[model samples]
Target: MTAAKPIRCLAFDTSMTCPGVAIIEVRKGKPTIKALSHVKPNTSRSHAHRAEVIEGWAMLFLDKHVGTAGFDYVVREDFAGKTSRSNYPVLSAWNACERATSRFGLTFAKYKKPGKDTEYLGISATRVKSLVAGSGNAVKDEVEAGVRRITGYAGTFANDDESDAAAIGLAWLIDAGVIEKPKGAG
Candidate 1:
């Protein structure tokens, strides 16, 4: 019997200063992290310039991966809320990511804030943490540790941003049934 083809996914945690990105492949319903990286914006520049630089970086990252064997899905963490005063930059970056992914005809799945509902498709942050760290309230380090434990990833993570991004991707894998739920997850 032949094995089922793997599903390749590109996931991101969008931010103004640094955005986390990961490419994963699911084979036989098991997800494996293939590549992980972050887009660091030049903070010395003005806000507008920073946004442009971040968008350009994001585009470059996507361009580099979109054609390499091609990705079957693109996922990202949704904005926390629209009312926050600091949401503008994040929204801008997210919009750019959406546009970039759409240009390739890929529908980006936006994982919403934990325990919230919106018109767009999403999975809550609480759900992501619970699935990834066995606790919805798991702190950054714990979540990062959980991701390494679950994926058996051996490389050192650059920062919490990348870890969170990886967690976001792992959440999508669990939600899509590409991977089994971690033990003790509620």
Candidate 2:
């Protein structure tokens, strides 16, 4: 039988100021990082402008790298509207990502193909932390360390945003069976 095509997962740790992105590719059940970067839109700009910048950036990135083939999964850290005040700005950034993913033809739900169990949308930060660090309440530093251990990545991440994006992507990979879950994970 012929070999299967490699699967790509693009994950994001979305924020209005600086959003992180990571692209992970799995081939034959082994996973590797394809790219990691963050967009730092001007904080002085209005929320609409920042959101627009983020949307444009993501569209360009997808076009240049992922192309028409697109990613098998696109995930972002869920926007938990925990505060009483309206989280309009944060929601805008998240919506920008949603638009970008939709533009590439990825539906905001789990794929419905038979025998395929892939998720495609927001994943809770607590869930991502639990999957990556074995604790739902894992701190940012702990999550970063756990990502390093799980992915066997030794290089330093530019910031926590990048590491969080990696964590989010790896967690999805494990959940989707694209990569094996690490030993001793709860």
Candidate 3:
């Protein structure tokens, strides 16, 4: 029997105030985050308009990233709070990511006939945090440290929401055994 190919993934966070993206390329047994980007919106502008701005950014992100072997699953964060989530930044973030899900689905031709579809996973921030930091209540800094601990990334991670977003994808990759550990642990 032949071996299976490692799945590739592109992950991003939708936020007007803290827009970020992360992509993971898993080839063979080695998996690495190929790209991570996070940016702060202009202070002069409020996040209320992010729905539109993030839409544009989503289009740009897909235009640049989507391809033959597009993301197997586009993992993103979701909220199920009872309160309306149409707040400025929150609303904009949702709008931006929603576009990515639709586009990624089409890009992968998952919408074709039947039994063939690319799916997206909207992970809760708590779950993702727990997977990485071993605690759902892990703060952003703790999460960042966990990322570095796993990936050997050394930097401020100040704008690393994109990196963290991508990290979730990596965790899924590891959990699914699409990627393996480096060895010499315990």
Q: Name model 2 segments beyond 4 Å from true.
A: 84-86, 110-121
Give model 1's clash tally.
1
Model 3 misplaced regions, further than 4 Å = 1-4, 43-48, 85-88, 104-121, 154-158, 174-186
Please provide, for model 3 over 107-170, each residue's C-alpha lDDT reduced to its tens digit, 9 standing for 90 to 100: 3111121143544335567766766666778787776766666666665555667667766766
Give all candidates' CA lDDT scores: 0.77, 0.80, 0.62
Clashing residue pairs found in predicted model 2: none
TM-score: which is higher, 2 or 3? 2
Per-residue lDDT tens digits of candidate 2, residues 1-186?
A: 988988888888888888888888888887777788888999899999999999998777777777655688887776657673447877888889889878878654443223557543467787788888888899999998888887678887898889999888888778767788777554
> Model 1 off-target regions past 4 Å?
82-84, 110-121
Q: Clash number for model 2?
A: 0
lDDT of 1 by residue, 1-186 (tens): 987877887888888888888887888776777878887778777767777776676777777777757777687776567575588778877877677777767787655444557545445668778989999899998898888887888887888778887888888888766788888875
Among the numbered candidates, top lDDT falls to 2
Instruction: Judging by TM-score against the true structure, name the best candidate.
Output: 1
RMSD of each: 2.7, 3.8, 6.0
What number of clashing residue pairs does each candidate have, in the order they appear? 1, 0, 0
